[model samples]
Target: MSEQRTVPETETETDTETPEVVAPEVVAPEAADAAAAGLPAPPGGSGRSRRVLAAVARWTAAVLVFGGVGAGTAAGITAMERTEVPGLATESDGRWEYPRLSLPALPQGSPRPFTDGNEGEIHHADLRALLLPAPAGAAVDPKANGGWTTRDAFLSAYGKEDRPPLARALDDSTLRHIAVRAWTMPDGTRSSVHLLRFGSVGYAEEFKDALIASEGGGVVPDILPEGAAGAKMETYGDDIDVPDTRPYIYQEPKPYGPEQIRWAYIQAGDTLAVVRQSRKGEAAHVPFQQTVTLQNQLLG
Candidate 1:
């Protein structure tokens, strides 16, 4: 608990009607008796004195009841010296005036009210409902008359006769699954996500086109023959510098990740991904040739 400081200490002296002691001449005891019996004050004191004292006591009691008059007659401050914060020469309006603080009021129609930064972080979601970020810049979908079912139709959209080897695709029912697989950086600061699409050739081509478009690149048919896993690993690895990563766990907390990468590679299936790196993390590659061997599985 905080301790309270005492208000300024003041020394006050006062004249309390000191009764005058009179030398009573040798008067008859009978006369003094008659005066005392007839009045509240005896012969030596006047009845007025008793009445005045009583009045003073009542007045003092009333003023002190709440708070006494400050630094004045009623204050009972009879002193030889000074006081703190100068006595008011004029009647105090009795209202305490505080310093005026200048600040800017908020905009008229602005939605959110005044809030601390930490409080703002909490309420940001609600405020964002009124003001949202621009929509994601996604690629415009290509024009197609109806659902594409044939290998040639969808393949044509990616590219016609001039399409890279990526244009050709083979469907596989051996392991049909759509999954999200990710590769993490060594320091665990980043992850590259792939939506692994493993199925027939038609679907795989579409997925592949989408993936390449996202990467802002087209497949290289001349360098790596069509549908060849080993050729792709070498070609893509060289193009992408796959040699520069540390050891990365294919799966997180192990619910079937490493094997999935193997399956994705061997199935000739396509994986759609957007790569993001952790600003703060760690990777490596290869039994050199053996590492190339593993990455080649995707070419299947």
Candidate 2:
């Protein structure tokens, strides 16, 4: 074998460079803390924070809903206890005395307050019960009969002209209430009555002046129609001898001598009573008698 190798002179091959193996480097605790402080939170932690914020928002909404419900309940209770007027009832002579009023009978139905009944057919809050010891019939003229709460309605009912001036003259604010009734009698006689309440006697007097001016061209000396035969107006006040009284009466003669139309106004305390009657072609004392009867009732 030694003699064969020396003769052939064969060579062995070897690498000049080789790669080195290295393990992965571990992260330092200080580097991890620095990243947490300067950078945004991880996805998992961000999701958990969102869940907590949603829970707080839901809790706040529930609190507001309960608070609103409580406030509404209290307001509803207060509204139910309100009264129309203060000190509206009183006692006298071992009996309760209260404001009581009535309306005259009509051809079809009785006159009732615009505000009436517990549920009130008209203005519910404006309604009040009249503590009357007994029911009384309203004083009325058979010719004109109806009821309304406002002057506009009154003018419309009678088909009067020049409504604006008259409406202003009879201002609704000046009167507490008004009731009207009218009808044509079986014998062709026409009549009407108005029951008005004023804040005071002085106010009633002022209203009376305006009323006459509106209906009969100005209150002074009375205006007469062009062809009137001889219109006469008779007023009776202290002359009647009733206790604490001032009354107004006027008789307007028609163009024809036989026809008679009369108007009367009376005051009892804060109330003003009025009547208008037209006798077609005859004379009767019924209108005056009716006036006297009403005057007596008011005084009583």
The candidate that achieves the highest TM-score relative to the unseen native structure: 2
Candidate 2 lDDT tens digits, 1-300? 000001112233344242232323333345456677996434344556656656666666656666776677578656642331223322222111112434223334422322233121121111111111111233333333345345554445322344554466567426677766565544555555556666655666566665455434543333222222144656554444444445566666445555676656655544556655566675355434444444334332
RMSD of 2: 37.0
Q: Which stretches of candidate 2 lie over 4 Å from their true place?
A: 1-149, 153-163, 212-231, 235-241, 257-259
Let me know the TM-score candidate 1 reaches against the reference structure: 0.20
Which residue runs does candidate 1 get wrong by more than 4 Å? 1-176, 181-186, 192-195, 213-295
Highest lDDT scorer:
2
Cα error, candidate 1, residue 273 (Å): 7.1
Clashes of each: 15, 12
lDDT of 1 by residue, 1-300 (tens): 001111233444445553333332343355567777895433454567656656666666656643533435445435422443235223322111212222223355432222333321111112112111111221212331111233443233232344435333324222233222223322332222222333333454454443333222434322211121122122333322222121112211123222212111221323222222222211122212222223322221
lDDT (0 to 1) per candidate: 0.29, 0.45
The total of clashing pairs for model 2 equals 12
